[model samples]
Target: GRHQANDPRPSHFEYNGVRFGQDNLNVFAGLCAVDTPEHVEQMMKVLRDNGQVCTRMGAYKPRTNPYAFQGHGKDCLPYVFELAGKYGIKVIAMEITHESHMAEIFEALHQTGDPTGVMLQIGTRNTQNFELLKIVGRQQRFPVLLKRGFGITLDESLNAAEYLASEGNRKVVFGLRGMKTNMGDPHRNMVDFAHVPVVKRLTRMPVCIDPSHSVGTRAAGPDGMLDISHVVAQGVIAGANMVLVDFHPAPATALVDGPQALTLPELPYFLEDVAIAREAY
Candidate 1:
């Protein structure tokens, strides 16, 4: 593997003083398509009730359709920061798409007084956007979360992380959100569970799995939660340092990724299963 051969292994890193790659399991509840203060409050309550303290929020959504919900843009960031403070969340992961977005992010941080630590996420669509990666790497103000592209190989994924590290920012986390495959039986993409340990050994960066997108199933009842719990448990046991799942108060009306979003009621049980799985490791 190129990662194993040429790359200098990344050491453990911290976000807001919480060290990853240790015994601690970082659980990031994905809050996708959040548009208003009301949604923020609702999601915050759900997270706090379950003792979850970190979230992957998107104030900027890049959609396939121009008419689709393009998130609330950067204006809603203040509300996210405000609610994150009220809920005591320590880390918030948000995506950066262009060089111009850097100014908006800095302005939001200034206005919100930097309530919680911000992690710059490079979504699957932008995994190979080297220009954006280099720009973000130069900032060095926050850590980077690089999700593997659905169609990219393991080598390409590692190289994407190297792009950031080459720019002198080594605080990078790799997200394995499943790779695109021909099998379309039950999930959107086939999750390569074996990649977890391989990535840990090759890059030494903290690895997280996005089961919601990987499984590609909607929560109907306890059965849906069961399906999600199964995959999440497997990911943790496979050596993932973090787990990222999407949850909404009402998925039926969620503006984005509704089918894969777990309803609020099912979160506690899912988190319990994740905790037990991490203990097994």
Candidate 2:
């Protein structure tokens, strides 16, 4: 259904006492390789300083690479949650696997002392599983932040959100990352910021951008942050209500997608000129 500006149709919800998509603009740093309490604390510091939030997983995901890092799974979740609790930071997490482990995932989320309020993240790989999407939306005890499929179109992405909403769940905020294309381009992925305004106009789902996964290149240049920030500025101006980016305490030593993750200390500067771009163009 179409939405009016006064209605604020897609309202944000609180997770673990932290809110997303409110009138107050907020950002979240996706923590993929964050595996320790110390790193979690450091991440919270980054989030606090930048006024952002982070999402780390409970299960160690190596993702098809036989030689990926498999840290402590549920065992590590508790520590990360404990540290996040202390920092007044929000967390968006992937629920381990599908059904067979739903009970365990719920138990893990509940132990965070925030089952009913935490943010549930569904990554691209699991985007089209209608059954799974329905479960996450219908039975979910918390707010959901759904990610766009790297290979999906704008409509397909919105349909994923509609998948949840159609199932009696209205607490959803759709995420728009990037799509992959072979347009004689060398960039690893295409950041389709154009979809931002489109989605917002169609259904009132607050749109969020993920430049980390959208960049066409997996290789970082000397001035990586500046380059990424330039694109990010374009996204916000295009009508993105929020952003979900990946950053690591030490990018050079990260375990997953090292090239795309922002250096912990590089965030503030990236956000510096964004407002100027927003106001000027």
Could you say which candidate leads in lDDT?
1
Give the TM-scores of the predictions, in the order they appear: 0.92, 0.83
Clashing pairs in 2: 15-117, 187-216, 188-216, 188-217, 189-216
> What stretches of model 1 exceed 4 Å from their correct place?
1-10, 219-225
Tens-digit lDDT track for model 1 on 125-224?
9999999888887878888889998898888888998888888888888998888877655677787766888887777688988888787776344664
Q: Write the per-residue lDDT of candidate 2 for residues 9-81, one digit (tens) a residue.
A: 5466555666555333346665665566676678777766776555544354537566677546567666666
lDDT of 1: 0.81
What TM value does model 1 have?
A: 0.92
Model 2, runs deviating above 4 Å: 2-19, 22-24, 53-62, 70-72, 93-102, 115-117, 216-225, 274-281
- Could you tell me how far off, in angstroms, the CA of residue 150 lies in candidate 2 after the best superposition? 2.4
